[model samples]
Target: MSTRSTDPPPIRSRIDRALIRGAAGATAVLLLTSCATLSSGNGERDNVPEDVSTDITDEPVELTLAYTDDPPSTELVEGFTEQHPNVSIELQQTPFTDYVKTVTLSMSSDEAPDIAQYNPGAMRSLIPSGHVMDLEPYVEAYGWEESFPEATLEPLRADEDATRFGTGSLYAVPGALSVLGVFYNRELLARAGVEEPPATFEEFEDALAAVDEEGIAPFSVGGLEVGGFQVWNTLLNAFGDHEAYRDWVHGAPGSTIETDEAMTATGILTRWVEAGYIPESANATSDDDAKAAFGNGESAFLMIGNWAAFEMEEALGEDVGFFLLPGEDPDQVPMTSGSSVSYTVSSGTEHPDVAAAFLDYLSSPEAARIQLDTGFMPVDTDASTGEGGVLEEINSVYGTAAEQDGIVPFPDFATPGMIDQLTPGVQGLIAGSTDEETFLSDLQAEWDRVHG
Candidate 1:
């Protein structure tokens, strides 16, 4: 099993610092302190040379990688080295809680790794400072645009300022993917008279009501962390316009989240709270505790991602089932929030070609198998999902989303402080202390602080 902490890092302070410095003077300051500083080459964006090559050196070469996720990272490194026997990668890992700050500092220091795991919020500073290489040249050379899914690559592109993403130069490449969905307890759902998974949004609400009427907790929520907003996020996916939401998240000019559809989605959660569908103590519940409760059958459902599939399947076996949260129109394309275990090449790296080669391997058929075995959706969606059960269910839904061009970045990707706003804002909604307008307004305010 992976040892990465499920807990999100304490992000407010580090993120704010990175944004402020990244937007203004972070690059200049970083260059002063680091020996591996890039030259301000004439007319070059991010100081990356126009002449990029896809070939790696056959002679002995060594590279270091710093990352948080292990199941894929360690095994992926081993896989790459196995293919290119002359190249060796030394792995340096940090816990998820410390990964952002640790990597941000190290990537600017003389000791920067050749590659580092990419976190949009934490690593925004690296973009402007030119600490990370812009990979558009490599993308053209390797024809990644043709091989990788466009939906997966969209989140990795950002303008130079880092204020917006989903367009502009590519900074990272995905190795594995994850999608948000609902996990239901089969026995509990049957007990509540839900014969099968709901295919429409209204049907989903009826299921929740039925489960509540049966005296079973309808949902297990992790209000203390990302679970709460993720619930809202899924609802917004069902009710809101996919492109508008993506634009807002990408920091498009004049985009806003305070919409009628958003209000409608938030109102649904409010009604759920009033109906006691969500637990009263949810605001204090951590994600792990909430997932554990669902696994033990204390709750009828948990809205989470595929990352929880391994443990859920292990605990409940055939009793646990997975499905994407249905949309308002049953026939509408599936839209859901997803992210990747993606990697970025540091500009300071001595072996840019080798690092890029590692990224390219992620889309290979062999790497796809490692991604699947490690409990993540493979970067190559064409790879076969496992034989049966929750893992297959997840891959099936994720494939549909990817094929339809319906996947989107998580809302927290909008800005660094967005998570700080979302966690507390959703907590107030669960506690009935914050109204829908207030909750959304708080989010927009945080976005404005960074991107206005």
Candidate 2:
């Protein structure tokens, strides 16, 4: 029943400025040197200083944070400053499309903000340039390892080369959590004679077929953007090897996406495309358009993250429902890809301890309430939603995945530019212009280019 403004601030102008500056600067940095060389003399390679306490002085402190996500960012900052009245936080909001590029330049610049949102695309360069702080010390002092979920922290860790993940030093901590899943319209399903949410892959397809038979679009996907890949990601999680997928995404040496599981997942998606489950014009549709279509009752299902929950609820009321994509069998181990709206401290911050304290505050019960109110899952998994609805359903499924150690990082996270490959590759699959082999091979090639 928590309420807060979920509308993101307008950032088109800011995004344009940030993208121009970031692309020009980041490109030069990427070509001029390797990450190892840039990070070599930072002196932070060793453990964080033991005396680097979490304690902040009573003297008034003002900090700047550069971020893209608004609801949680603005609300979380309010919660932190309410507790520490003397401290003030100024937020710099940017559009997600421009965030990675822009934040990279900002982090590397001399007047970097005290804190910046964690973007892996930017981190590959920032972590190596000694611009971002290694937060292991703050983690120990704050006991964040215990406060936050391990799966939430794994993707944020990386080697000095910024290649491998799920190991090495911790860099960022999640302020909020989100899981990818299937969102369905209850009325649409009922019209199609679906008694309940599907329990297995076969049943899920049956529902799709039933919906299509009733002249309804069975699925809504924005193949032009991340939506296309997300559909494949959910399918792979349901059908593939979790450990292998994790290893590949984490940049483990010799890890790959070319496997029987991946092939089977791709083939299933191909079959769905051929069966007209996914619309032919999906490749031209934007993510917003697809979400709108689902919200307007133009489609029955949306394969996306909980970030869309608030909007869906607003549009469909109690008619909208959510569930994790079912596996081949009902008893298959719970698994899905998730990530955090996380942040990192800047190495140039004058108030490192204060920044760390802000990060620590994210795990508090107060911040958990803000996170859920702002349409994000709390880092503290046990935080209650206090009632039953879509959020409860999501938490139920996400909780099961978390408890069983089944959550995995997203596939696009495998490399800096993997999204570029995945989007078009999925577009090809949807268009029937690419085979399963080409799609996975393209992904592995991007991984090898970065990890080699």
Candidate 3:
């Protein structure tokens, strides 16, 4: 989702530049900002119930939860395990780089966890194979649909034309909540003499230019393989003149990435690399490295999700800020975001009722507060529009853009292995191994392979 940036120059100087941009050749920096577990006013709240716990049965009804390493948010989880002591859980952490494959192999096994942490494409394979359960009945009985915002369920709900859309039935429960947006440092802007973050694209570029004159990197990206893909993927949705964003994602044949809008975004992104507005070496940088660089003040901006809030605060301190990624056309979608996180009942579960109960419990307004306090957009209805919870500053941008009908889901969330198909080509694009025409053609080729 797009973050709302203060007008003129939403980003300022609190950049932590010491974080190294590492993917291929770059090294990571160790610039640490002031440490205090920063919060924007009412940061984290004691929202977890006095007896916060998971429902685990002691009769060996065990499930394993798989997650990639982002350990800070689990701050309170370890302290709240008393309620459901009967159930035991195994925590499996994978590197973000290896998560996709690890999830795939585990799912195909009979020994798969009854409950596991699943991401976008992981459920696609299982849902289609009838390996997962349909949660609709449970959803109805529990009123999950009533309290649940339909948008939050978009990732789980397959379109009626499932063959055409590849949205298949809901499979895994959504675990994490995240928001994707362009991040900037306030102190960096002040050093560049920029007054505020730009509301429009032209001004945004101007800020990049101001940062450029000082010989500092203006943007950070993990362009090699998946790293380089994030920025391009983001821009594709923001400026997608054609509805190619979803079509390209669903891969329902003839879905080429070479739409006019796709080409424009690619060209501009490539130019950003050439102009040094972004690090030319981003082609080899990992996502972590780029994030660290931005946090350490080596770069001026980062296009990232809300989960990275803690990391940024750790690297850049209280002076850090965010804003919406400006779209080429304001009337177009403000910017695109992924469903990122959601919860669904496992089709294989014998205790569907119990699982569904857990989801409902997790969706409560109180639950939403727990999530907001974790620094993410909540699926709960109240948090999205209720009192000033979460970052009102950031939510203002997201809410305004969404209200204007300016939101789109991430391409990967719409289909299976979009990242698998799109990333190599984007990495190729960055290296100039493929021209704009061929990049689109390749994208279409992948789409055809999947649909036909």
Best by TM-score: 1
At residue 22, candidate 3 shows an lDDT of 16
In the predicted model 1, the residue pairs found to clash are none
lDDT of each: 0.81, 0.81, 0.54
lDDT of 3 at 13: 22
Worst 10 residues of 1 by lDDT: 25-34
Instruction: Please provide, for model 3 over 129-192, each residue's C-alpha lDDT reduced to its tens digit, 9 standing for 90 to 100.
Output: 4444455545545566566655555545554334443254454444334556777888888898
Q: Considering only N, C-alpha and C atoms within 3 Å, which residue pairs clash in candidate 2?
A: none
Q: In candidate 3, residue 395 scores what lDDT?
A: 58
lDDT, candidate 2, at 190: 98
lDDT of 2 at 386: 83
The TM-scores of all predictions, comma-separated, are: 0.89, 0.88, 0.74
How far out, in Å, is residue 206 in model 1? 1.2
Pitting candidate 1 against candidate 3, the one with the higher TM-score is 1
- TM-score-superior candidate, 2 or 3: 2
lDDT of 2 by residue, 1-452 (tens): 00001112221111122322333322111111111111235544332433576566677889999998776787778777767767899999988777877898998887889898888878888777778888887778788889988888888898987878888889888888889899999999999999799999999999999999999999999888778888998999899899999999888999999999999999999999999998999999988899999999999999988888888888998999999898988998889988888899887777777788889888877777777777777888888888678877888888788888888988888887887888899999999999999999998999899886
